[model samples]
Target: MKNTLKISLKAGEKIYVNGAVIRVDRKISLEFLNDVQFLLQQHVLQPEDARTPLRQLYFIVQVMLMGQAGEGMEKTRQLFRDTLANLLSTFRNERIRAELKHIDTLVGQGKVYEALKAIRALYPIEEQIFNKDSLQEEQVFAKAVGE
Candidate 1:
């Protein structure tokens, strides 16, 4: 084992571990003796919330970790790769691009939780980009109307 991971959970909190969904009835702590793939309820992103490009990518990777990979792991991984490639080509933000690459490395190493964290961290930046684009479009429309 590389290192043990300790997790605390409140009553009714759900955790997805190695494709198993576990819900604790009372406050509890779990110490994993070995590395495991697990996701807490709070980190799980709803399908509707995956509205942006990076979020959509996160959702795809989440599927792989959550064991909801409909067809198979291989197929889902392929989808992840394809979606990531598209995002890499679509965004010009240097920071976002660099972080995306780091996320990819995490995913490649089977560090899905770390990758999710990285993706969540980029949400604010993504929002800023979208907001800026919307503002620019509104400005262009205002200028045209004034002409």
Candidate 2:
């Protein structure tokens, strides 16, 4: 029998594997964690590309999930922690948070279609802001108050 593991990505990407359906909505934020898991698996199976930021974060999340780490693993875990901290510290986007929360609720209530619609609405904005450093911080409060 093939062992199936359901993993979710909270960054708005849901994928089903084997007989398991993994919901990637924001309430759980599983995508970021899964990304870390992928990185760790890559490191153990293929160490050559472990230097990348994404891979590094994966390694750290893996170590933390494993409970204990040894020599080399400890260093890698620390690096991952530092990188994640830095990323989270500078990553302040209220709209994304609100959207993610809404998605999570929709997914939990089995409203997949509505969740998809919500995600679609934010896709363009997400892509634009994802890597850009100079984009104006959107005024989420204004929109919230208006609503």
Scored by lDDT, the top model is 1
lDDT value for candidate 2?
Answer: 0.46
True lDDT of residue 98, candidate 1: 99
lDDT of 1 by residue, 24-141 (tens): 9999999999878999999988999989999899999888898765568889899899999999999999999999999999999989989999999999999999999999999999
lDDT, residue 75, candidate 1? 91
CA lDDT, every model vs. true structure:
0.93, 0.46
Tell me which residue pairs clash in candidate 1. Answer: none
Error of 2 at 22 (Å): 23
Highest TM-score model number: 1
